[model samples]
Target: MNVHIEVRRVNEAGEERTRTASIRDVARAADVSYQTVSRVLNDHPSIRPATKQRVLDAMEELRYRPNQAARALVTSRSSTLGVILGSRGEYGPTSSLAAFEDSAREHGYWVNSAYLRDTQPETIRAAVEHLRRQSVEGIVVHAPQVRVFDILAELDVDIPYLGLNTAERGIVELAEDQMRGGKMATEHLIELGHVEIVHVAGPQDWIEAESRMRGYLHALSDADLPTRAPILGDWTADFGYRAALELSHRLDFTAVFAANDAMAVGLMHGFRDVGIDVPRRVSIVGFDDIPLAAHSWPPLTTVHQQFAGLGRRAVTELLRLINADDAPPLLASVEPSLVVRASTARAFGHQ
Candidate 1:
């Protein structure tokens, strides 16, 4: 049923006209039953694809848009997914969010994201409670901190949830092969003949950081190179700068591999300030080739993680569990690429 309002006015000088496009109007234009139009709008799986396409084409020709409140009342599902993320400002999370939203819309669902202002247990609990109130059908947890898992375990909510990057054995989780990525970064430096390569790695709690560190160690072990313990960092440029200055005192390694591009950029800045030219004196490499990495002062040589593909994969896996579909075949690990740039060069005496 559609509502119509009559607007009466004088003729000629001031006249009123009726204007509306309703579901019934769309059905009449499409020459289909009103129930068929409703089925198309609701994305009923039973409808034949040809019929659905025809209904969609007709709706477009008639300019049909459904009323949200009315539709939700009929469907009994929110058509919304909750996204719980650590931060919205970071390059990785934001990139993942874009892919997640795009994929959700393609599947006829909307997103409700919560960028945690605080990561405390109480704060995280509150955020989940908030999403529950919104009646979100599922959740996509983009929160990468180790503490996040702990909190979620405590809540143990029954709603379907997905993680962007974490090792949760049976659940849906997606992570760029951080270990392989780490090894690639380290191996690239070794190929450049940097014998003494130190690493400025992200904090120990992060799953990626730990995997990357393991890779670094594995590569060094394979090459019979010295295993110099990495200096832990906070995944920030400021920390990178400070770590570089601290390195000036020890100054044993001819190369450095920071865990992320931002830190690598900061390390370059720090090296420049102290007159230690990159590649000439100290070669450097980083990970997660952020948008600005290619344009950095020395053009950071880093590992490129396919975040867009990862996001899409996460959605696929999550939706599989959400819809109770058969599990997908085992897929190969996401390969991270080593992007060589001007930041690394052959060892001083290797020429």
Candidate 2:
């Protein structure tokens, strides 16, 4: 009679150890090929159910675990996406980041985030480089500053990239219809019989602010109303306060269209401090109906940009680009709606 016994090896510590098992080991135990084990490990749909079960059972019996790092190297895909966002404490950026996170999670991708307070070209390049070093499959740039566009233009990254709240520049761009949003706010105020309107604009460096200012101008021109240079603000309540103080000296306009709801709320407070009543004296309208817009003394009538949807779409587009070999870059826009609230009413005497 002939008999065979499996022999294990012992190290200097005198502990017996079995050789580390691989997909080949599992396949041999399961009476399958290495390729079949690989397909099962990757959850390929074409694998037969029974075969997959046998491979899984073999892996269990051999106590085998896949080396994820080696697998990523072989596939050249890290299954991760990078997002660069502004550090500003504002509704637009904050809401967008949240939406991107939710969307990426649903798509089975992990998000790595980087925040910048000021969008300098060098800073953006550094962020992109950092994400690339991590081998993220793609990047989602949430910087709305035009400077970001300039910076991105200089980089020669082979990996796919997407922009959120910015226009397309040879890459996927997703944003709300800012021009429409601005027009909606202005037209609503105009319909309410406010002929003289002032726009308290945000920082000109941001594409959103610039687009909104254009829309405001377009609405005024279409209505044949006179246009004035926008009073620049920094998308901050404090800036709106100072702007309102400056405007109070002139007191020439019957209505104010602030770039965003924060400025609108601030303008209302500033007006109140100067003995001016909202809607009663000067009707106010704002863009980006942030949460605070509704909680104002009199709820704010403003344009609601679907920030969450924009964020979700940005991630979707980024993923699409990442998975495709020759996917055309796209520019997607989410529609914004006007929300009528107490902050606006027909010009005092027009009603």
- The digit string of per-residue lDDT tens for model 1 on 245-307 reads 888777788899898888899899888888888878899999999989999988889999877
The lDDT values for all models are 0.80, 0.81
TM-scores of the candidates in the order shown: 0.82, 0.84
Scored by lDDT, the top model is 2
TM-score of 1: 0.82
- Runs in model 2 deviating more than 4 A are 1-36, 54-68, 170-176, 325-333
RMSD of each: 4.9, 4.9
Question: What value of lDDT does candidate 2 attain over all alpha carbons?
Answer: 0.81
